[model samples]
Target: MMRHLLPLLALLAAPAFAKPDADTRAWLARTAELSSDAMEGRDAGSPGHARAIDLVERWFKDARLQPAGEDGSFRQTVPLHEVAVTSAEMRVVAPDGSAVPLKFLHDITPRPATDLPATLGGAMRFAGYCSAKEIGAEAGPALQGKIAVCFGSRRTGRANGAERLAAVTAAGAIALLTIDDVGFLVEPPRWPDAYARSVAHDGVTLPSGLPQFRVNGAALATLIAGSGRLAAAILTDAGLHRDLESFDLPGRFEAKLTTSQRKFTSQQLIGLLPGTDPAKAGEYLLLGAHIDGYGFGEPVNGDALYNGTLDDAAYVALISQLAARRKGKGFARPLLFAAWTAEEKGLLGARWWLQHPTVPKDQLAGVINLDQLRPLFPLKALTLHGLGQNTLADTAKAVAEGLKIGIRPDLEPERNLIRRVDSWPFMEAGIPAVNFIFAFNPRSQEERLYRDWYVRRYHRPQDDMTTPMDLDAAQDFNRFFYLLVETAAHAPETPRLSPKPGT
Candidate 1:
């Protein structure tokens, strides 16, 4: 309802801007300690994440939150496998038999490959992007055992490089060597840094097959420098023309690779607060935040510990505080609090729970997801993550209005936030879910405090609870989130998926 939030910020901010409060400072301290350099980026399958989860589970016990996990434990187990590149060797030789070898992880990344080998000999066809339009007319048994020179658009676009490379592997093509397309510009193109960080950390080894390769744009350009024809010219040629002979050099080749899948496990921390109503005590209100961060580094950014502070530790601390407050108060519906493990690894903890829930998934009314807590843009109007999936948004908006805050739609619908957090698994299992954040739009006092104070302390080592935070606002936001949990749990009528559907 932050109905008057805009004007309120204007009236409340210091004339020249000011500092945050105590609660925020404390929250920041806990946040810093959790995601600090000492913690090494709370990775899913790493010791760092294990310690973080253990600490959280201990705190949950100390808070007197009931044990609400499988059997009598406060933890859930998730299993995973990794497919890594073990050993590899690649070379480009001419008809004259001169060798042109490339480095394995450097000169060309094998890009993820299948678990088989491929050999192609005859005429190498330069397939531009492997697009139907480019290679549509070049159908030939000749392409059956030959190489295909195409340009992978890199990580910046919708062009599924891995998927397309997979087709080459299936086609039994010796190998696929691609370059950057002009559209593959330098903006880094909205890559999935979050998931990528996690997957890279939880790095796996896969089987070998028709592998893929990509060179840096400049190095690729340099590789093409002496060539008389442009890449597109050779790739799109209709006939196996003599002019395109350079790209067809040493048409016969064999590519072999083997990536073995390996197994590993992690734990999810769970605790509960019993319900007040005898009848609905069996029902549950699920609240969650991921305790894990990127475990290991990938090829792109070598940051080992993906110490995720604002990404989620803040939310965990917030949930922990709520548990402390409600432990004695008693909720109408049982409260199931979770600090997930391996969340970065494809929400494995959540997925595991859905497959083996402590309580029947059908009895659950809804889920409240806590991931990022920073007011990224000083939310003028709170944005609903799933647009219109639940009345929870309406309830949240109503609360905001009551608090004189505003409400708005999400900036990016394509992101599908509702499906990205822990709440998503529950929603998929048929429960309502919502993710809320502290936002300051319309340049409110809160928004001002954020830019003037919160941003720098965000995910960095500085996110310590001691760092100056707007404690008052933190209290308000945390309480507001807790209220949502309380209201949904105790309300005479359960929160439901809005008629139109929401998240």
Candidate 2:
């Protein structure tokens, strides 16, 4: 009789476990809606982006979230200026005074300054990998008043492109040129079309008036041949060692760029769910995701739309789901949900918020940013950006443990991912923040899937509604996220940045 009753109980519970919860279903539907073709990839300042914003606003209203933006509105405007190259001509002048014409988008890609002059010319100087220390010491004077040429990719600890450009221009360099070396598993590099469309904040001026160009290896080799320095030898040395020697090359390169400019504005959507506890409600927990992606661009596989389903739309959907889940029953701390814009345009929206926050910056407890959450594998582990930087990591660890999910460190820390997402601006503003990514073991099927998705779908039209997803993994992670927020909200104290030892 006991065995018969056990079988009957198992049969009775089957239906409860058969279907996904209402929240998970709603999340998936919202993701599909956002990634639909009608959204036009949700590019900033575009009609499709406007529709996307309206959709999010509707979701917020339906969830009964309070407007937390400027003037009790849900929109925060971000002014932006866009510059695109209309025409370009470049030549490498040999030591013998012969000129070799370089082709655009093939041999080299020109990145004109936002406010460029009608015509420009300079003698090219090879500054090797222009590290900050090198620029401050030897390369600074050497790069003065010339077109500074340097390696595009650098090893860890070196100044990135923006930093290198700032240092070079401050050193009085007239222009900048970067040569691309072949990277691991990314051969015959495909230059990004974004160089043709440069966007920047309208009020923020660049460090210099230098026009920059990223030349292909073959083109750089052509220029290096005249300098009596073999390109292969330089590349081999740079590849073998972390640091390389800087020197003055033997050529004068000239480039002229014609550009067209336009000014436009995009908006960041913000909403608030007030906490049940008024004392803790004063300090808010920020949750955010970028709602923009590359608009229509060069078509791949007969598709021009970059739907960005997993690139960001999925996470934005998660935001809506969370808002709806806690609508009537609020947490202990208020929740601030922000759908950021112009993230692909250099994190402008987040930076703008840092400059103009809805509430006082100190009133913020911490931030959890979501972007490009592709749930293609099981939820065994998660990679938390800025993991050990603050007390939030402790909360996250506890929550993940309760859910039986492992918390892992960023595997590709060399990518500088912490500074690459929406959380960076908050971190720079002295706010505690963290970003999440699904984790996979080294060289496993999960790793292979992640690599394949990045190579094929990331920033491409292939990341559309049709892309396969692991729904169970997504639901599990969503559950963990919901619980994590509740745990943080009810904690005795707001999350704070952890001080380094001996500080």
Candidate 3:
């Protein structure tokens, strides 16, 4: 009787262990609240988004996180502009003076450079992938006063459309054309009406006096007919051998673009956890997640709102949870929690933060970004984007390994996942940054689930609260992320950008 009584007393004296189900249920509750119809998809600058801001601010306040924004508030305002092509006309002239008229949305899509309408024309030049190294020294003179054409894909490395446009525009090109294969469409299927909406971004002037168009295979064939090289042959060679050869086309191109513009403001929510060490507190680690989604768009299956549950709402909740868990805990360096706006609009909010950081830019040690993480399968492995690009990879690997989770490099580099998230802005600003995704073995059912999610739910209305989820997997990942953040914040030395040699 005495021995049994002692055992019971020992159990009672120990601290209560948190049940896994309870934690998962709490997280799901938050996700459901954020993804509910009442949020209206949390579109940036909309009343729904305003409600989201209020909700997150309340959460931060509840967690007792110190306000890190200007004027001792939890909000930072970002000024932006929306640019869209209202109407566009294009004509490709052959050497024989035969003109081919291209239809909008069917043959090509015009991405306006500014809000102004103008007509521009020039001789055509096929610049392959328009890679800076491929273009070489003579490209400046050759591309001048010409419409430079190239393949629009990740085969050109980090230089995507906007980057390529900036390069050619700087080289004096009057216009740019990119050939995109239908198989590489990034967004979900949409009707012609979707093109009527403009894209938003920070109000930065475009690099050059050139407009860019993303044309399909049909339009490419028409533009390259007079060049003696078949568009099909060029595309086939590039696809098969992954090599592109630049050449001069024996024709000219003309475009008349009309655009409309609107200016508006959005807010990024920021909170801080000051470090215990005064010396290291000035230096900070940034953790970020985008809070905006496609407000209301083309409906699918009788649903219209894109709640973005897995896309980012979960991670934002994770940030709030961490702040609550770590309250009053001592740390070497400060932890900055940021909920960015307009990530779907081309990483605009993150970019704005880089330009106008809440903390001094130089003191920023590293950034950990969370975007579009889906845990549909068991958490056996983790995918770390920008792995080996910095010392942070080592820290992430160590934490994952301790938890018996394998760490893998980005498997789908062709998707340009590294540049697509909020971390990219910090990386571009010369700071070490990393983003995460769940990993699965090759040819496994988990892989199938991952692929199916992208096809059926990514950027779609189907990504709402009603979608089936693996809350256990989500809870496990949240634990891993929390450990990773704590490790980085308390490390003796902050993570730095130290790329592997020859990378």
Candidate 4:
């Protein structure tokens, strides 16, 4: 009687496979609020941020995932500093007794908001795109003891736009700011300066200094007008291929700034899916996404919240749903499900986790990072974002083709999407991680249809689940993801990471 009951209990206790429904849509829909302007971009340590974390925790519980963080609590406390720039008093002084006062938070907002006694009468240095120019002996002018004013653009399409801001700040520049150089008819809803940046690994390192901050459009515009030579230094037919070396905006301007800032602690949400195969249970597979987004930046369509709708809220739902489905099903290894914190603060959460994982490096298998939900084009084919590096790329291809899904190779690697998602840490550690994405391209008539539809409702205040969500598509992709995981796990031995390109 005891043996018979054991089998029945085991069968009944199995996890439920995720099902797509209005309920699932509703579950995902809540994230928009967390990303909404009211939440102020969900910066790591804000009250609104805590609210988002709470919602994610509730979802994990509802999905039946065992607490993957400390002491049966799904929260892994990651101490972080929440830098808030309460106010700034900055201005420009001309040759004459003319005086112009600049808005502090409006003119500049840094990575770590500062709280100095609201005054920095530093000399002003005019830096053009912050590039080193090649010309006569005096071309490479040095910037010291002065605030360096440079364009926000740096390293092209591969880096987070915040980086150039961060770099200059690190170089001892007292103040930092940027302006729009690209042309996008429909600017980002709230995060006007946001890089639709899908790849790259930055600090994710524990932040050590104040995030030298600056304001968006309004302040930047004021500076440009004062800059005078702004047009020739930045807006010429420089051609995309030629480097803008030596293009310095030569002039002397007096700059000063004053502000108040605050800092706080942030945390990472983590959990685990113990594998069924005992022999390989020690090895691991990781899934992750940054849980924080731009709480607020520029205003969009009369709305000021930079809710990262698809920026990453979609990934949190995707992971929660996937974890609930795969837990104890048939995985043979420990699969770590991580919801990183303060990613926008320079990969604060993920960088920290990579260096301090629960398992050792040798025990790691691979990683899968989800950044946003690609509701457009619906994956007519599986296009591996990073296709040149390893065997995992081939494995992804085989899985997609075996499943009869078309395999469209990465069309433009110049975009360098390989490092775009949170998968960079795993991939950098040689763990063969891959990013699964559904992207929108407006250049093509065919692609534009989806691009227009998806981008229009993608990240704004209007990014709720009420409009045009296709459950069938979501379910289909989830199914594909499930099978891919199964194939990797059920392999006779750990899948080899020595995979070459074109496999």
Best by lDDT: 2
Q: Give the 10-residue window scoring lowest on summed lDDT in candidate 4.
A: 195-204
Number of backbone clashes in candidate 1: 60
By lDDT rank, best first, the candidates go 2, 3, 1, 4
lDDT: the better of candidates 2 and 3: 2
Instruction: Write out the backbone clash pairs for model 2.
Output: none
Question: Residue 32 deviation, candidate 1, in Å?
Answer: 1.8
> TM-score, each model?
0.71, 0.84, 0.76, 0.72
Residues 367-455, candidate 4: write the lDDT tens digits.
Answer: 76777456544556656754556566667777877866776655544445556567776777777777765543447653664455445
lDDT of 2 by residue, 1-503 (tens): 23223432342244543466677767877887887888889888889899999999999999999999999899999999887777778887777888888876667877756667656676767777776777887888878788888887645655678887888888888888887755533222454443367777887664236777788776777666556678888777766655667777676777777888788999889999888897886788999999988878767677778888887998988988898887756788888999999999899999998889898878998998887577888989989876778998778988998889999998776666678789989888878888888889887999888878877788888887555566678889999888888898889888998888789
lDDT string for model 3 (1-503, tens) is 23223432342233432244555556666666666667788877888888888888888888778898878898999888777677888888887888999887657777765634478788888877776765665576788888898776654353576677777877778778887743353322232222534555555764235666777666777887766788778777655546677778877887787777778888889998888888797779988998887777756676667778777787787787788777646468888899899888888888887778777889989888888689888889988976788888789989999999899988777677888999987888778888888888878999888878887888777776545556557778888998999898889887888855886
Q: What TM-score, to 2 decimals, does candidate 4 have?
A: 0.72
Which is better, 1 or 4, measured by TM-score? Answer: 4
Give lDDT tens digits, candidate 1, residues 9-126.
4423535224445445445455655766555677776777788877788778877987777679888777766655554565554455564555554555455434434332233555
Cα RMSD to the true fold for all candidates: 8.5, 7.4, 9.0, 9.0
Which scores greater on lDDT, model 2 or model 4? Answer: 2
Clashing pairs in 3: none
The residue ranges of model 3 lying beyond 4 angstroms of the native Cα positions read 1-20, 87-107, 115-150, 156-175, 182-203, 216-238, 242-258, 277-279, 298-304, 326-332, 497-503
